[model samples]
Target: METPNRQGRRRIVVGITGASGAIYGIRLLRLLRGLDVESHLVMSRSAHLTLNCETELRPADIHALADVVHANGDIGAAIASGSFHADGMIIAPCSIKTLSEIASGVTSSLMSRAADVMLKERRRLVLMVRETPLHAGHLRSMATVTDIGAIVYPPVPAFYARPASLEDMVDYSLGRVLDLFGLEASLAGRWSGVAAKRNPGDAAHVA
Candidate 1:
């Protein structure tokens, strides 16, 4: 990680939606905790269901990982306002529905509302989109957010890490996203590229 967050605490807003890769969001929260970064979490209703279906973690367990938690409907939460300073916001395993809502500036949920705040405040907003085989509309929506300074980071696995387990792949993806925030949350085995397997690849070669 380079350059401490301009603001204090290096606070981050995390949104977990109803996407297949619930583990990405979970792992992100864990990494943030380990890195001692402040995290504000907001989850969609469907995320609860998926959390149960995908992993052993319960709602309380996930909530415990974050320093602050906001309801999906509570648009009035502190994070929803641009006045509330944060390093950035990340929607790990960002569902297509959630992505669309933010892209359209709908702000239908607090998740999107907080993301909207990131955009209007000119703060980084990273969306780890979980879907595959994107269509034209998906691409357009991604382009829309990108046009507005948001990053559409899909959770594609990086094999260079030589992950021996599923968790390794998840951490690798989360680490890459965290790079956008300049946070050192990568799991062991970063590709230095000097050897391409030492300290992890630089951002330019990360893709």
Candidate 2:
């Protein structure tokens, strides 16, 4: 379907790279579908390998979740242009390789190109970098991106939410990331700060 290009409905560019948490990108798309937002998706080749190993969904199934899917090599895609008018871009499970490319302004793939566009345009760029034991180079790249006004959001589980299952954790992360766009996903666990005032036997679940 053609995008409406209508006012009020925001558009977000979603990029999935070769990282451990492809679920973050997938869940983000699912959440976007429920909100008044349009998602344009792009995935690196390594992302496909990771998705196959980490998720049950097939490529087509994954592509179906987004309003538009741009090829990773398609640097000429609409999202590559600053005039595309997207609200922002999110790179959930952003790989170190992709991060480096964007930090260096290499634009090796559509993911990096779109992210570069977002940064140059002074648009919101949130990256859920998925890595552990970050080294000096990783730290430097993160700082570089941050210097350029990109949000280096690592998808750490919020144990304070008292999640019941894996989905709950994933949804909570997605909701919080969506918040960066100033879009609210009500599924996220909110802290009321008055939990102790509740009944001793209360099993208050975060919504």
Candidate 3:
């Protein structure tokens, strides 16, 4: 797929819910900043608690990375309406509570409202649900969202990158997610399967 023109930077709404992996949301912001994408952020109350529990960075520090930060309780934010155009929205480390809200079309907070707007506007919506040992409810919720064209991406690691640090792994995961929206990123390693496909005489070998 062709990437959108960069004349104006793409706008992506990012929501950090109460999930345990606040690092995913933080690293996603950093990666989006590096790509020059416009980020609109919303953090739930539970997300604040998780942030305090997981990382040393303050809320202000996290807000600094986004172009605009809206309160999670603010359903009046531009991102919460379909009239506000955005390239897409991502709910990094989406909590089960938030996921259930979205799946059920309950838009109580800015995060859930923005996701609903994304879907209704026919824009891309990616949810990195951070739950394990899924129950039937969780599976059904996922299926419901998937039926509505939202991507349910689990934060799976890529061993092929041979990530040497936490940042490296985060970058790989974020890059892969961004790629789904046709965004180009150099943070993730590329596959070079041509070498494996070649016969000995087919090409000059590299050591």
TM-score per candidate: 0.88, 0.90, 0.88
Best by TM-score: 2
Q: On residues 29-86, what C-alpha lDDT tens digit does candidate 2 reach at each position?
A: 8888999588999988998999999988887898999999999989799999988988
Q: Which stretches of candidate 2 lie over 4 Å from their true place?
A: 1-4, 194-207
Could you give candidate 3's per-residue lDDT for residues 1-207 as a string of tens digits? Answer: 222434577888899998989999998888888888888999999998999999998899999999899998887888878778688989999998888988999778889989988888888999999999999999999999999979999888898778899888877888889999878788876987644476777666555
Judged by whole-model lDDT over C-alpha atoms, candidate 1 comes out at: 0.87
TM match of model 1 to true structure? 0.88
Error of 2 at 51 (Å): 0.9
Instruction: Give the winner by lDDT.
Output: 2
TM-score (C-alpha, index-matched) for candidate 2: 0.90
Ranking by TM-score: 2, 3, 1
Clashes of 3: 0
Cα-based lDDT for every prediction: 0.87, 0.88, 0.87
